[model samples]
Target chain A: MTKRSYMAVPFVLGALLLILTGYWGYTQNESRKNLQTNLGNRYQMAFLDLSTHVEKLQVLLAKGLVSSSPEQDLVIFSDIRNEATSAQGDLGQLPLANPALTRTNQYLSQVGDFAYTLNKQRARGKAPTDEDWDKLAQLQEQAGALNQELKKMEVTVADGAFNWGEFRREANEELAVKGRKRGQINLVKLERNMEQFPVLIYDGPFSDHLERVKPRGIKGKVVSREKARNIALQFVDKGEEKWQAVYRGKVNGKIPAHRIEVKPTGAAGVFADISIQGGKIIWFLNPRTVDKENLTMEQARQKAANFLTSRGYGKMAPTYSVKQQNIAYFSFAYLQDNVLVYPDLIKVRVALDNGQILGIEAMGYLMSHAPRKIPEAKVSREQARTMIHPRLDVQAARMVIIPTETLKEIFCYEFKVMLNGQQFLIYINALTGQQEKILEVIDTPNGTLTM
Target chain B: MKKRIGIIITGLALGLLISFGVWQNQEVTAISQSLYWGSKGPNVVQLQQKLKDWGFYRGKADGVYGADTFAAVKKFQQRKGIKADGVAGPGTLKALGLWTAETRTTARKPGTSRGVSNRGDITLLARVIQGEAGAEPYIGKVAVGAVILNRTESGKFPDSLNGVIFQPLAFESVSNGLVWRHTPSADSLKAAQDAINGYDPTQGALFFWNPAKPVSRWIWSRTISTRIGKHVFGN
Candidate 1:
């Protein structure tokens, strides 16, 4: 080939490379713009939905206050509950950081839960008390204020003066920078306004009373760090291999505990949390991989039972066992006089390969276990059986103490029934003969699970 | 000129034959591909819908084959007196009336069961744990999963697992698409199962963030519960 032709070939290749680069850049820009538009639309939709829901919540609360009829009040309260929940969900979908909207989120949750409780009361043929009306008035006022704040933001959004995409970018950039300026958007201002709502004390899960509940099961004197270490070692180390206990740190939460790391010689370490109050092992995990399944699930259950007995867990009845990855997780509830105390529940994980105790979680047990005066059943078991649907064929029945959503324990007659080849567990309140809860029992190849 | 034309025709015929052979080979392999846990496609959607119609599956037939689909497939297999492996192989597909004329049977090793009854929940949680704290210690992974669970229980966050995980900006891994990009390790799955079983090392922490990484300054306002591995947990 001629030298001139070779030089022309280089130019041609250079031109092709430029064209390819331009095409790639164009596609990248188009895709980025598409993604930004999609995200902006989502944020805008969520914000608008939140504003509408809040407005509806205020209206519903007002309607609830005016409605004296139980039937009308029930519908109004349900609407308020739904609107509040949707508003909370929409608020969660916004781009603001979680801590920025903590108060606002909490307010929405309490409002929704309070409405739910009122709905339940109205369903029970009870009229709203004067106190309930006062709480409703207070909540309605707060909802009005929240709706007003959202309206102001909505105006800016409607005027195209605020762009969630740009706000998200700027907020993320500000978060990355140290000593960043705060409150570029009015969300922080709105969150501050949310802080003035009255603290709700109700029978709901989110009630302030529930947050302050102390552990009913932990009753011993506070143990020293040395005693906690000894308790941890004794609970975790079952074999003869010497293990060293290293104090990790003290963790203060629902159950105040000292974190201890236990390691055998030349082996990887495991961590256990020992409760400071009773010096009992709250939970421990051995993270070793179990690659084989030599022991059956029945054998694993036996191993779990033996482990619990050795640890002084008396009369713990195995309720269910779920097997996963060569580890069988067995749930045991304390059995008191043939009445299963489900609130005092313990979970044990046994490796199916060697029947070794892999893990133990006793938080539920620790939170609720106590020697209690058993209550007499006012309603007979036969009476409770009559309350069940005729379609359900009763397979078994027993007395049990089940905890309500608010952690209040109630004695109930637990009946295992079958219908259309499906099994279900129905709990009837022993005193009132009211159907409390029904759980479907799903027996899969892995193990039995209750839904 | 006639001889050259004849040679060209022969070359074209040879190329057509080879292309047809390749196409046939591709069809055979495609037919042998089994739908198992973590598989996703239109075929999986069909399988799930078929299982649902047969009253064996109760989960949403959204196409992605997960633990629920696996369990349902196993149940169907058991009822049909086939091998009770949680995989949609040719025999199982044929039994479900999903097999086509081009489909072929191929033996495959059964996928190991993760053994949890709520397989879908654990799988999703495990993905989040794997993406967020895959490099952290075992306890740290479990702590991250526990934080997600605690968020579900907290009134300030969404009440359901899916709602909490998929909430906008709640998890950085979800926001950045990292959670879906990687398969969960066995250890991560175990950690998720442990968290679901109520083995919380964080003692009910609602949030966790890696101190070494750039995080929102707002998270600093939360009361720190514990530091596990590189992540600082708070409620």
Candidate 2:
């Protein structure tokens, strides 16, 4: 070979060696990582499995105790014994270098022996005698106690609560000395601490609190306006000394109305005014209540939700809007979009028992809901009239203007209905040609009907 | 010349063989360590055997590692009334048998009867009924529960009672793990079994909700009947 070629050969050979070594190293490292991860997952899963089994066995034992089902007790005991054996066999494969776990395993074996004997006897048609039950119960209690103790140990290990090496050494020391004498710690407390988190409570829209605080009298026996005002004041102040009442008024006759005023103790000029008519809230007058600049949609939503939930109307969802001045306002419905949250009337027909809320038609919620865009007219009032049963006598038929609850628009529609005999209401989807909703009314008192 | 050629070839072959042997040995070592540390292979195999022994898992222990093993594991979990995930995690292993050596004493703690677990089961069943047959009576709820249980019995759903309960939005409570919160009352269990036996008061209803309130329009397309609670039941 040429001298230069001979020299190049060694360089090429060295490069090849480097590449091969690097590839092998990478493969080995990757393999080790994968193995370690799999092993960790397996161990964790195994531990959890063991925990669940113990939990079930405990539950079964409890059932047996309550029902005094010796058969169930026997089954539980046998199952537990079998589980304990299987777990031990699985754990043998794990390299649980921790001494606490090792000691725990040993105790587990002792418990297993106790359970196995009881189960074996029970399976042989010998029900756990009272004495046997007592022994089993004691074992169960001890097992639960030990589990708590071990779990604490596990947390410490998993959370790196202590140095593993030192903790292991200490555990080993504890095991070697008092070993079985290690008493159970209060695990409930530990778990509680571990699980504790935080929640936020608000103190705004204070006027709405009246809705929650005021007690309702049966249907509409005249409610004292004075009582209602005091309740509203109490709600707005939330019993805060810093708040002072400013103004109150009543506008009434057709739709009864009330106006109320309040002033903050320290603030000047700024005040709150509210109005209610026919026992329904009409308007709220707090400049701060309307968010101008620094408010987010989420904040507005939360405020609305808070207002509704606090008012005992926990289910109502409110919509928010920005007024002309860029101030945000909130409004909700007794009947939400296409859904009758609060029915004006609920009619039920009971067949079985006293009665059930068989048929509930919320005409008020439907009529009072937000208007929807008019659906395409398919069947005119004349066509709808044809579909009605001839046997059903028509009392009233008119083309009156009504708001569309589903479409959120205004429309002219027809109401051709009768309340003469078997109560039924036929609603025509004037926008669409289809029958919107048919409600069969039941003739029964509100109190008499089972809800 | 021929002898020299043979010698060079033999040396090359020996080097190649050594390299291949080392590579194979490394792979074997990796696999063994993985098994030692708690690989699925070992855990799954052990769980399958335990379930078969317990009569919950009937699939052959071929060790191919698939859904059958999961189903068997789940069945064992359901019968034991444990939360079922087919993998033989520590919980499954412990349930199948007991672990005595690590931290807690290896003895199987006799299970406790928490008055709470039973009550919790009632709530879960109530929630399931509400979801399945809110408008229907006890019969409707019972039928829905039975359908869920039937799915468990057949190969279609996760076999464990919990697996069936908690099979991702299959039943709302099951998805939320609220099924675990419930203690299965004898009545509820009976109802579930009854529904599984093809006695559908709902006549194979897969969905139900209050008719007084607005439901998804899709529900209208299905043949709907049988109103209970506040909902309409349908297949």
Candidate 3:
């Protein structure tokens, strides 16, 4: 080739490179802008929806307070519950920090749960009591205040006082340590206003009263770190392996516990959490890989029962066994006076590879295990059987103490029945002869699950 | 110019033939390999999808042959009155209607095994753990998974695993696309399964954040539940 042609080729290649770079940069910018616009639109939509829901909630709460008839109250309460749930969902979708909206979120949850409780009461042919009316009045006032705050926010959002895209960027930046922005500050203010929400005590799951429940089974003096380590080391079945236990730290939560890490010679570590109050092993996990199935499911269950007995869990009866891979998960409940205490339960995972105890979780047992007063059934077993549908084929009958949604224990006659080739466990309240709960028992090839 | 074009066409055809030959060889090798626990590929994906369609598998149809797929294959084999071995060997494949001529060339081998009870929840939780605490200590990874579980149990958050994880802004990893972009490591998966089995090293933490990073000042208001690795957990 000629020297001039070679030089022209270099210039052409350079121009092409420049054009490619420019095009790539232009596309990247366009896509980034598109993404920002989409994100901003999502935030705007969620905020608008939240405002609308809150407005509806305010009107519904006002209607609930004025309605005297049980039928009208039920409808209004249902609407209030729905609007509150929608508002909560919308708030969750926003970019605001969770802590700043903790109180506000709690308020929304309690409002919806309280409304649901009221609806159930009205459905049962009971009108709202005076205290219920007072609580509804307080909730209505709070909803009005929240609606006002949202109205102000709606104005600021419409005026574009702060860009959501920028707010999101600022929210997620790890190094942007400075004063709060307009949008976040507004949310913080709203949360501060919610700090005065009246404490709600009711029969719902989200009631304030449930938060103060103490563990019924934690009944000993606090244990030291060394003692906790010893308890953990003794609890884990190392079996001829010299395992060293290390105190991890003290964990504080619903059950304050001492965390211990046990490492065997040249093996993966095992972690055990021992409750500090009683030095009881809350949970322990041996994360070793089980690569072969050498034991049957029955053998695994036997091993689990032996492990529990050795660990001082008395008279634990296996409720279900689910086999997956090389492990079998066995759920056992404490049996008291021939009545299964379902609330006091423990889960044992036995590796089918070598019949080894792979893990154990006793949080449920620790939370509710106590010597209970076994109430004599006022309704006989035959009476409870008659309460079940005539089509169901009664397979077995037993007494059990099941936990209600509010965590209250109820004595019931658990009837295992079959109909249309499907098995179900129907619980009839032993005291009142009323049907309490029914669970469908799904029997798969691997194991059984109750739903 | 016509002669040169003819030569180029011949060369292109020859290249195509060689590439096709290589592709054909790879396909044969892939088909001949038996799928068992820990095996991963398009074949495993197909196996899992087929099992899911037949109501034997309840796990996601990811390609990796984990415990879920192993148990599913075993269940299918039992139903088909096969040997009831978990490995998808030539015999098992033939029974599954996935057999090919290439699969007949290889002999069956015993396979490894592991298991999880709730396969669907474990997979998603494992991905979240791998994304958020993949580099953290093992306990830290479990703690992250526990936080997700605790959120589900709390009345303030969504009631189910899917609802809690998919709630916008609930998890940073979800928003950043990290959780979905990669598969969880084995340790992360185990940690997730452990958390699902109720091993909460954090006891019941609802929130966790790396203390070194800049977080919202309001986070400090929550009582500190525990600290695992670099992350400070709180209620």
By DockQ, the best candidate is: 1
Task: State the iRMSD of every prediction, in order shown.
Answer: 9.1, 26.6, 9.5
TM per candidate, chain B: 0.53, 0.38, 0.52
For each of the candidates, the C-alpha root-mean-square deviation to the true structure, in angstroms, is: 9.7, 31.8, 10.9
- What proportion of the real contacts between chains A and B does each prediction keep? 0.49, 0.00, 0.37
Give lDDT tens digits, candidate 3, residues A1-451. Answer: 4556555655655565566567557766976899888988899888989999999999999988788887788889999899998898888777754555667878888899899999988887888899998998898999999999989889878776657887766656622223354653377668778987778888888888887678888988989999999998999978787999998888788888888999886777888888899888888888777778899888888999999999999699999877765778888999999999998989998888778798898888888999999988999999999999998899999999998768899999999999999999999999999898888776768788676
Chain A TM-scores, all candidates? 0.94, 0.31, 0.91
Residue A412's lDDT within candidate 3 is 98
**TM-score, ranked from best to worst:** 1, 3, 2
TM-score of 2: 0.25
Name the weakest run of 10 consecutive residues (lDDT summed) in model 2 chain A.
A348-357
| lDDT for each candidate structure | 0.83, 0.42, 0.81
For each of the candidates, give the backbone clash count: 0, 55, 0
DockQ for all candidate structures vs. native: 0.23, 0.01, 0.18
lDDT of 2 at A412: 30
Model 2 misplaced regions, further than 4 Å: A1-6, A97-103, A119-134, A149-451, B1-235
- Candidate 1: lDDT of B195? 86
* Candidate 1 lDDT tens digits, A1-451: 4566556655655665566567557766876898888998899899999999999999999998899998888888888889989998898888865566768888889889999998888887878899888988998999999999989778877666667887776656655123243333478778778877778788788987887788888987899889888888889845678898899999978899999998897787879998888798889999989999999888889999999998899799999888889899999999989889998989999988888898899988988888978888999999999999998799999999988778899899999999999999999999999888888787778788776
